[model samples]
Target: MSARSGPRRPAGLGATTRAGLKPAIFVTLVSVLAVVVAAIASAPFRSSTNVESLLFQMAPLLLVAAGQATVILIAGIDLSVGSMMSLATVLAASGSAFGNSAVAVVAVVLLVGAIGGLANGLGVLSGVNPLVMTLATMAVFRGVALLVLGQPGGSVPSGLLTPLTNVYGHVPLPFVVALVAIVLLWFATAETRWGRSLYATGADERHAASAGLPVRRTILTAYLVAGLFAALGGLALVARIYSGDPLVGDPFALDSITAALIGGIAVTGGRGSVLAVVPAVLLLSLTDNLLNLFGVFSYWQYVAKGVILIVTLWGYHAAGSPSGLLAMARSGWRARDARAARGTKA
Candidate 1:
């Protein structure tokens, strides 16, 4: 037994430190703080009814974040998610006007989403950078949505909105649906071979391909999954608002990315879990709700959200130096040796 083998100061402290400083933890903490502040500031804000309303408002955002997480996990980003959502909302509303057949509305919405996703897949696989491609598609899709809707508004049938917006026996249906989807996604990423391949490809596409993974196919599938989720979010939005506006999803692109980042999804990819995103979505939604309750200006909300994102990201990088962990480790080792020599001379 050597000094190195002597009793250690238990791993619990390190584990606790890591957990407490995690990005998800920070998001949760900030969220709790915001809620507490909001409750104290406003007497009517502490009720269960308010909580339900907040969850209800967050449903679409949570759905979009779920989809965005998949795309980001694959080392890609989809700027067109918001535009696709807008298109879906318009399509669903139009379909409802024709016959009010829920199936028809759903099919049209999903079809548009799939087509938008296919465009993204083809662009990426064909050598276009994802940022440029999605950015272009974002403009195109938004334009198309504007052309279709010709304006900001269209009504969705009450039959559709009621069930979707219902809190089933005090349980919000949208929240429940989102929860189930998150669980399924968590399992898919954790237990499936495809999930492993996805992470491998995101970490290193060349190496993943050399290892016989179908990199292109995986990326394409990831984008498709993103599109599907965006469509679901769009549908939910229409249901909740009982109308579809051409600009309904304009804010979602930034909000979804912010949520995913806050949730601990690595921008560089291959270092996050879907479970981390749940708290992130809730945190953002709660912030928005509290601000609304206080009658804060919407423009100020956007500015505050942007500031929060920048600060959180800076803190995340500074905390672990994750981006330069290896380099920092080498420098620390050298500094430690220099200190040891100086100590011996003293």
Candidate 2:
């Protein structure tokens, strides 16, 4: 035998391949689950009308979650995303009410968001912990939003509203926008060299830098991209509510984080897919729908929602358990099978 096999495979190669496959499989299982849940919820839940409405409502969350996933991919988080969106709402409203026009409002939100993200990246590069830096920015943005709109009321330009909430060829504009985001993000993360660099950096920053990657630039790019998405999410929120509310984005930070996690984006970073988020968003939406249909008390909704997240994630986080998602999915599918069994007996 040769002293060394022709070329010993790099140990990380198997791991890298596994890392890529894990998210895809996890997403596939979760998607299958969301469908079954819809079927059980009600007949209308599976209808085209409901699909359109669901897509409309989910559009903004998709935007926000898409960004949140990217941030987490690089072992970073942006707590201020919700505040960035809140700022968008107020800015959009004030601009419309003040006659600043649709294009002006969009421009301001996207621009400011990018600036804020730039600041976050700079802060982290200067050696501040990313969490602390982003948390501080979150406070600043929320304070600014409150200063702009102390109350839960303001106008969204009629011109902006028409296209966002309106339909085109049986598809709402928001749905189309969300689709574009997914496609763009998918291409960026899956096809580009910078995207590969991001995964490499997240997997091991030291190693990535040593491999000739521009680690700092990649991190900054992720933040900037996240900011753009947050701005877009804010625009979607404006369409949905048609007004500005200081607290409009309060739920986004948590919801987007949860959605990203459920979608197979790891909290530790370096592994996930925006494509997975499609099904995860639907699953969360379906859960909310079922809660409403079952007449769950308003106050209890939080408890129920928390329970769902916990149970689902508990199996997911179980260490070395051969994929927590597979376990949760198996249980979920078995439940579906049981439901079918009862139907057969009936």
Candidate 3:
């Protein structure tokens, strides 16, 4: 008697994956259109320097979004990701305090992230709401980050950061890292058994458990993965700035969630595609780059992001759900059938 043989197994999981891909595909097409339009309309936006800048900007956000999406897939959220990122940067920059060994700092940062994630998971298992538990950890992690660095003043070895900036024909190392993260995560969520289990657990926890899935472990793993990715994002940020800032990651918590949602991840969980996040990140990074090229005030970029987020959310919901493209298609078919029936009667 395997979990797959359980009465809970149905056609929904396969449909869910396909449904999620619809929004991802839509976002990808839109992202491509945006790139083309921006390049055609603005010379600077298409320049080599700006292209590099956009890629650099997209790298860290993509990493963080990957982690955020993992948590979201399991019907959970990790608000502390931003704080975890902030903590990672400070820890990495504090290598001087830890015998100036980069490896030790990196190891410590990852460890802290794992511990933080595990704590969140354990709290959730103890009946704490995921939102409440992560919110509390968010404050705690930020506090620890501040206490460690107090401000943006620690340095990373230039030697280590240089390779991250190396560009081969305009493809920076950071962007390559982001691409790798995307591929690996896409594989995990799409091909692995654990990945399928994640969707199951998220879709219906009680049924997933009855089907013999390790519901508790799945939840824990999701948070742990998120923490590690946030840490990786923080490391990427360090490569960008060559220093640590306790406040730098403050925007990431919301931004990652925005990207995930915009990319087609349902807020309710178990109903989105990780692959969709790439275009969502690209669109966001492009919007910022284009805004700068057009000389828009920095504050207005926030307004623009908010507007885009609202429009996408409204559009997705109106269609049906986060996984609404499939639903929209089905509705279209039914409507066509109705129209044909009416015509025949006439």
Clashes of each: 0, 0, 0
**What TM-score does each of the candidates earn?**
0.81, 0.81, 0.87
lDDT value, residue 83 of candidate 1: 90
Residue clash pairs of candidate 2: none
Q: Decide which is better by TM-score, 1 or 3.
A: 3
In angstroms, give how far residue 95 of model 2 lies from its true place.
Answer: 2.1
Query: What lDDT tens digits, residue by residue, belong to model 3 across residues 87-182?
Result: 988988888777776677778888998898889888888999999999999999999999999999787755556676688787788789888988
What is the C-alpha local distance difference test score of each model?
0.72, 0.72, 0.79
* Candidate 2 global CA lDDT score: 0.72
Candidate that beats the other on lDDT, 1 or 2, i.e. the better one: 2
Error of 1 at 266 (Å): 1.3
Error of 2 at 100 (Å): 3.5
Top candidate on TM-score is 3
Residue-wise C-alpha lDDT for candidate 2, range 156-238, written one tens digit per residue: 87777777788775577877898789778966876677776776665456556766778899999888877788889988888
Tell me the spans in candidate 1 whose CA falls farther than 4 Å from its real position.
1-23, 96-98, 169-171, 295-297, 318-346
